[model samples]
Target: MTAVIEVQNLTKRYKDKHALDNVSLSIEGNAIYGLLGRNGAGKTTLMSILTAQNFESAGTVKVFGEHPYENSHVLSRICFVRESQKYPDDATPRHAFKAASLFFKNWDQEFAEQLINDFQLPMKQTIKKLSRGQLSAVGVIIGLASRAEITFFDEPYLGLDAVARQIFYDRLLDDYAEFPRTIILSSHLIDEVSNLIEHVIVIDNGEILMNEDTDAVRDRAVTVVGDKAKVDAWVADREVLHREALGRVVSVTVLGALSDDERAEVTASGLDLAPVSLQQLIVRLTQKAGAETSSDNQEVR
Candidate 1:
């Protein structure tokens, strides 16, 4: 499949700091992408640049095969749903949807209305008067109902409760199945969005750390459970990402997929392999960022 979004050597500098350092990533069509990173890691910066909402210090970005900045042809095919979306002080959810209906070619008024009812959003209330969760709901509805070919949702569930978040995820998947467009979701709630994402893009300190199919990433690490001594012995000399112990039992997640022989050996040793959690995998990848930087410093010296 052709890439719908292509970013090459994208760099965004803020005075002395580099917000995005030579970042390059391509996202394919009809895939749900999870853009994940710790705070200040440039996930938002990259999204802004891709959507033409922010300028890049140096690099190229192509959305739908055209530059997005000031280019209506490319811009019209995309929707950016931000947590803190700006609205005219007196604008209400009804007004927001009305504007979206005019902008997005594939806008579905019926879908928007359904979302409003499901989210219990007050359409008549001024946007400024709406609570944080309500404000988020407005953005979520616009994003889902717009049916843009490529939609970027930047943490659109900030103040929503667990139930509301679930509703958003379910509705997003339902709508996506019917529409079949590329959806790039930037979220911190990894476990919640894990099942929805087809691919995972991890950023650390303004650079791409890991970009792979979610299933492939899961296979990169295997969690072993058994007696503490047996699990520890199995993990020895392997790159252990996470370790947890419960009484005499221990669970250790180590990098690398085991071969048939290795798997048989592990079971023979009385240790069982468990599925690695997406959250755990991401945590280990991002947490090692500091160690990676430190090693770079040493090499530079």
Candidate 2:
């Protein structure tokens, strides 16, 4: 399978700040990729560059095997649904859908209509008058119905409630199953979308931290749950990513996959091994880096 998106030595600078630092990555066709990072970690910047909505200071970007900048052939095959998607003040959901239908090569009118009804989006109401959830719904509708070869959704569920958010996820997964396409989602709600994403790309500060299969990333750490004393003993000398305690019960997430000897030791220790959540793993990794940076700054001071 050919790569749908590729970035080589991509760099974006604002004044003296580097939003992206020599970031190089390739997204294969028909995969759901989760762009994970803390705020100001360059998630939006990278997405904007990939979609040709913003220019990069240095590096190369190829979408659909060609440069995306002003290239109608490549541009038309990609859809970027973001929280700040703009719309004409007077336009309604109906108008936005119409415009998207015209622009996207694989626009599905029937699918769009179905989504509108499912989301209960009022077509007659002007987009400016719609609630925040409604605005997000419009974006989700277009993203799914457009069926673009490579779709980017940057925090597209801003004000949606739990029910509405679930609807969006369900619909996205369903559509993706039938019409497979590369979907890159940047979101802060990690736990919610953990299962939906097969691949995870993590960014920190201004650089790529980790890019691996979701399962592999999860396997990078394991959680041990048992008596607090036993858990601590097992975790000592191991790189602990995170730890939680509830009275006598304790859980510790340790980095590095368990070796055969280690596994036997864990089993012998009367401790149960629990699967670590993707969100927890990412949170710990980024938070650890943040803490280290803070400590270094303090030392400098």
Which predicted model would earn the best TM-score?
1
lDDT of each residue in 35-149, candidate 1, tens digit only:
9878788999998988889999998999888889999999989999998789998898899999999999999999988999999998789999999999999999999999999
TM-score of each: 0.94, 0.92
Q: How close to the true structure is residue 99 of candidate 1, measured as C-alpha lDDT?
A: 94
In lDDT terms, how accurate is model 2? Answer: 0.91
Candidate 1 segments exceeding 4 Å error: 226-229, 244-250, 298-301
| Local distance difference test, candidate 1 | 0.91
State, as a TM-score between 0 and 1, how close model 2 is to the true structure: 0.92
- Candidate 2 per-residue lDDT, tens place, 1-301, comes to 6888889999999999999999999999999999998889999999988888999999999888888889999888999999888898899998998999999989999999888888899999999999999999999999999999989999888688999999999999999999999999998789999989999999999888889988888779888999999888888899987888999999888898998898889989999998778888888899888888899999999
